[model samples]
Target: MYRIQEDHLDINQLTQALTESSSECGAIVTFVGRVRGSSEKNRSVKEIYLESYLSMTNKAMMEITEEVQLRWSAVEKISIVHRIGVIGLCEPIVFVGVSSKHRKDSFEAASFIMDQLKISVPLWKKENIEEQGWVWVSAKPSDKQAALRWRL
Candidate 1:
């Protein structure tokens, strides 16, 4: 499942999503993303404005989850969440969780989900700064490269 909210994410909800799965599981791997004070562009950070195309973002996340399942036999479940609207520095931006029978599968799936989401997810953000002003931060090329490694 997926959602966009201005409020803080619920770790309980993320855990619950990964726990509810079709394939029986033993281990669960999870990741939480947070906003940073600095930008890749090396500018002073203030707040971030997040946005996305609803249907496309949801579709992309679901597709990535399915791909994780198809590639890893040990995987049992996956959950992802991304926040939208204004977010301050150091605030959690998103979360990805994966469940599996073994650590390897859960670990790989969790990492893969985050990497894939970076590029595929339709969400966008703007970096706010004191002097530099607000600049839109799109998905990075490195993120695209990371996602390409998992493409079908």
Candidate 2:
């Protein structure tokens, strides 16, 4: 599921959603994204404001979720939630979870979703810093490279 909210996410709810009922899975990979205090130059940040096209954002995420299912045979569950609007420092921004019969597939798929979300998702963040003023930010080349690896 996708959302654009100001309230904090419930981790227990996410964990419950990710837990699979089937006994075939041995590993459940999870990646949690939090608002970082560092910027492009590793400067300290006070906060970040995230914006996005709500309708399109959910559609894109669902596409990635479907791709995760198609790319790995053992994947049993996938859950991703991204928050938008004014985000506080060190707060959770996104959550990615995947379950698989083996560790390798679950890890890889979980990593792939995180990378793709960073690059492909149409989310924008404006950094609020103490020394400097607010500045809008976009996906970096390193993030693009991370997403590229999955396509290859």
> RMSD, model 1, all Cα superposed?
2.1
lDDT of 2 by residue, 53-91 (tens): 988887788888889888998998887888888888899
Q: Write the per-residue lDDT of candidate 1 for residues 1-152, one digit (tens) a residue.
A: 55666788888877987777765688988888888888897788998999888889878877887788788988876778788988888888888887889989899888888888787778877889869788987677898888777665
lDDT of 1 at 126: 88
Q: Which candidate is the best by TM-score?
A: 2
Give the alpha-carbon lDDT of every model: 0.82, 0.83
Model 2: lDDT of residue 6:
61
- After superposition, the stretches of candidate 2 with alpha carbons farther than 4 Å from their true spots are 1-4
Off by over 4 Å in 1: 16-24
- How displaced is residue 43 in candidate 1, in Å? 1.1
